[model samples]
Target: MDVDYELIRTREVRSQKKINFPDKVQRNVSFEHRAHGESVEWHYEENEGVAVISNDRLSDERYVHIKRANVMDDGVNIRPPNDLIEDLSRPIYKGMTTVYLAHEDMLEGDIRSVYLLTESQAFTLIGERTDDSKELREVLSNTPRFLPIPE
Candidate 1:
């Protein structure tokens, strides 16, 4: 599936989903192109090497969406993306799913190779690639260094 994730702010979502997640938290917002009425946002928490699904959401206008998945040692407790669940316990796996990030080599993009980033970095190579350098660093500065995903 070709998902063109748009980085929107809480304000932009006002006319869209209407739900307000904490700002500065990076999210891979998903929307159905054909069906313009429905939308879902996958809120994730980036741990060291793992991106935890803090919440799997659905729009009031739309229903057929995979709820959030939880990552646990023995087994996952949350709902899995229908396509992703091989009837197993893996919570978050974007197999074949594309991540739109400019910095495909950074710890964030390294979590998933097919990432989405800035237009400039999309074509260029190397060094501090993110949606916006100033904005990204600002976000990172506030994010706690719990478990930084290693390179």
Candidate 2:
């Protein structure tokens, strides 16, 4: 499907509190809803190149409430430049939002770890959501013979 992938920023916070632990965290914001119609999640990401969402996607009764930000020790070393997926696209704004709707659910996780984001640290992830959304409707309007989009 023709999915309009976008990242939307609803709010931004410069945390006054800091946490020191296994890893360092910059900023954190909590969302009210779950990803796949169930389960809550906590997104753990770095201020640099590494972002990891730590949450339990297994249970329907649990929802993640991002308590606060954390400060941690220095992380692992870098990888070869060639091994990295270089995003040469435009400069993503700090509070800019993108929406991608689809006929079927695209994002499997309620929480996503965004890497190499030079701007905002935390924001809402909107894409291939409901069946009747604009994203899904637009994709259904066309047909592709080439095959599914490349990874």
Candidate 3:
């Protein structure tokens, strides 16, 4: 079966906020959210590179919450932590001008997907996955930009 993949370009505005942890709990983590709508917000942990969607007005009862950790090492000399490479072999975007679209239901949960992405697309997906995380942004900024390979 051929599957349709959608390019995820994050359009949300992100901002940092102070989190009040429980009085006895000791943790060092920065918090932020990319607002999707009035009832949905995308939150991420900067240090851990994990993100989740919090939807307050969800009407569906069968919906499950899933957390995703974006590839932190940029797949250069490093590989995705654990087995993500086997799971998400397809890059979200392929080439400079390539784009893919699919219904939200077509993509979900922990699963392997197929797509190849251009360098720019990789950057965009990385930005979305990390919620525009500060550390990764710094790493990406310091890295040199390259032209996408022609197909």
Best by lDDT: 1
Q: Compute each candidate's TM-score over C-alphas.
A: 0.21, 0.23, 0.20
lDDT (0 to 1) per candidate? 0.29, 0.26, 0.27
Which ranges of candidate 3 are over 4 A from the true structure?
A: 11-13, 17-37, 41-50, 54-151
lDDT of 2 by residue, 5-116 (tens): 3232222212221111112111221223333321223322222222222223322222222322222223211111221213212232323322212222223345332222
TM-score comparison, 1 vs 3, better candidate: 1
**lDDT tens digits by residue: candidate 1, 1-151:** 1112223222221221122332222333222334432233233222222122222342323122334333222221112244423322223232222123322222232122112212332223223346574565444344433213343
Better of 1 and 3 by lDDT: 1
Ranking by TM-score: 2, 1, 3
Deviation of model 3 at 82, angstroms: 23
Q: What TM-score would candidate 1 get against the native?
A: 0.21
Query: Taking the tens digit of each residue's C-alpha lDDT, what string does model 3 give over 1-151?
Result: 2222233432221122112121111111111224421122223222223322332212223222233322212211111222322233232221223222122232342221212233345555545434344544444444333111122
